[model samples]
Target: MISSEYCRLMARYSTWQNTSLVNAADGLTNSDRWKDRGAFFQSIAATLNHIYWADALMLERLKGNGRPEETIKHSLASPSNWDDFKVLRTQRNEEIEEWAARLVDADLNGTVVWYPGDGSTRMERPTALCAVELFNHESHHRGQVHAMLTAAGAEPEPTDLSLVP
Candidate 1:
C-alpha cells in the first residue's frame, strides 16, 4: 500500500518530468513528432496523448467518479495540434497533482471499482494500488515519449526522481 505523501511526491515528479518533456519536444517538427517510432502508441504525439488520457481516466476513478468516456482506442483523440496539446497536457498534470494533494490515508486504504474502456467486466482494486498505478502509468508512457524524444534528437531533462527538485 502507498501513502498520501508518496502520491504527492510522485505528482511533483510528474510535473517536473512533463515540463522537461514538453520543453524538449517543442523543438521538434510536426512530422518528426508524429513519425511512427514503432513504440506501443506508435509516435510521440500519440503516446503523449495516451498518457494524458490515462491520467484523466485514473483521476476520475480516484475521485470516486467513473471510467472516462474516452477509451484506449481513442486515447489519442484530440489536440493533435501541439499548442492545444500542451495546454491540455499541463492541465492534466496539474489536475493529477491537485488530486494527490487532497489524498488522505483512509482514502488509499479502501478499494476502487470500475470497468475498463470496453466495460468488459467489473474491475476492483485496492485504492492504494490504484494510487500507485496512476503514477506508474504516467511514468510508463512518458518513458516511451522520452525515448522517442531522444531518438529524434530532442533533449529532455534528466528524469531521476532525486532530480525532481
Candidate 2:
C-alpha cells in the first residue's frame, strides 16, 4: 500500500509533466500538433487527449460508483478542441490535485476495477496501484508526445521528476 503523501506527490508530478508537455506542443502549428507521426495516439494532441480520457475514466472508477463501461465509451481522436482542450485540461488538473490532496490511507488501500485499453476484461487491484498506473499511463503517452514534439523541433521541458513544482 502506498501512503497518501506519496500519491499526492505523484499527482502533482503528473500535473507538472502534462502542463510542460502541452506548453511544448503549443510552440507548434495546429497541423503539426495534430499530425500523426505513427506514434501511439498518432499526434501530440491525440496523445494528450487519450491521456485525459483515460485519467478521467480511472478517476471515476477510483472515486465514483461508476464502472469503466459506464464512463467514456470512446477515445477522443484529439484534444477537445484547439481552445477547449486547454480549459478541459485545466479542469482535469484541478480535479486531480483535489483528489490527491484529499486522498486518505484507506483510499489507497482500497481497490479499483476497470477494463484495460485492450477491453479484454475487467480487472481489480489496490486503488493505490491503479493510481500509480494512472500517473504512469500519462507519463507513457507523454513520452510519445515529447518525442513527436522534439521531432517537430519543439523543445519540451525537462522531464525530471525532481523538477516538479
Best by TM-score: 1
Alpha-carbon lDDT, every model? 0.86, 0.80
Off by over 4 Å in 1: 70-76, 118-120
Candidate 2 per-residue lDDT, tens place, 1-165, comes to: 678888799888888888888788778888888888998668788888888888888888888544565555664445546678877887888888899999888878866776666767867788878888878888888888888889999988898988887
**TM-score of each prediction:** 0.92, 0.88
Best candidate according to lDDT: 1
Off by over 4 Å in 2: 74-80, 115-122
| Number of colliding residue pairs in each model | 0, 0
Q: What's model 2's lDDT at 160?
A: 92
Q: RMSD for each model, in Å, please?
A: 2.2, 2.5
- Candidate 1: clashing pairs of residues: none
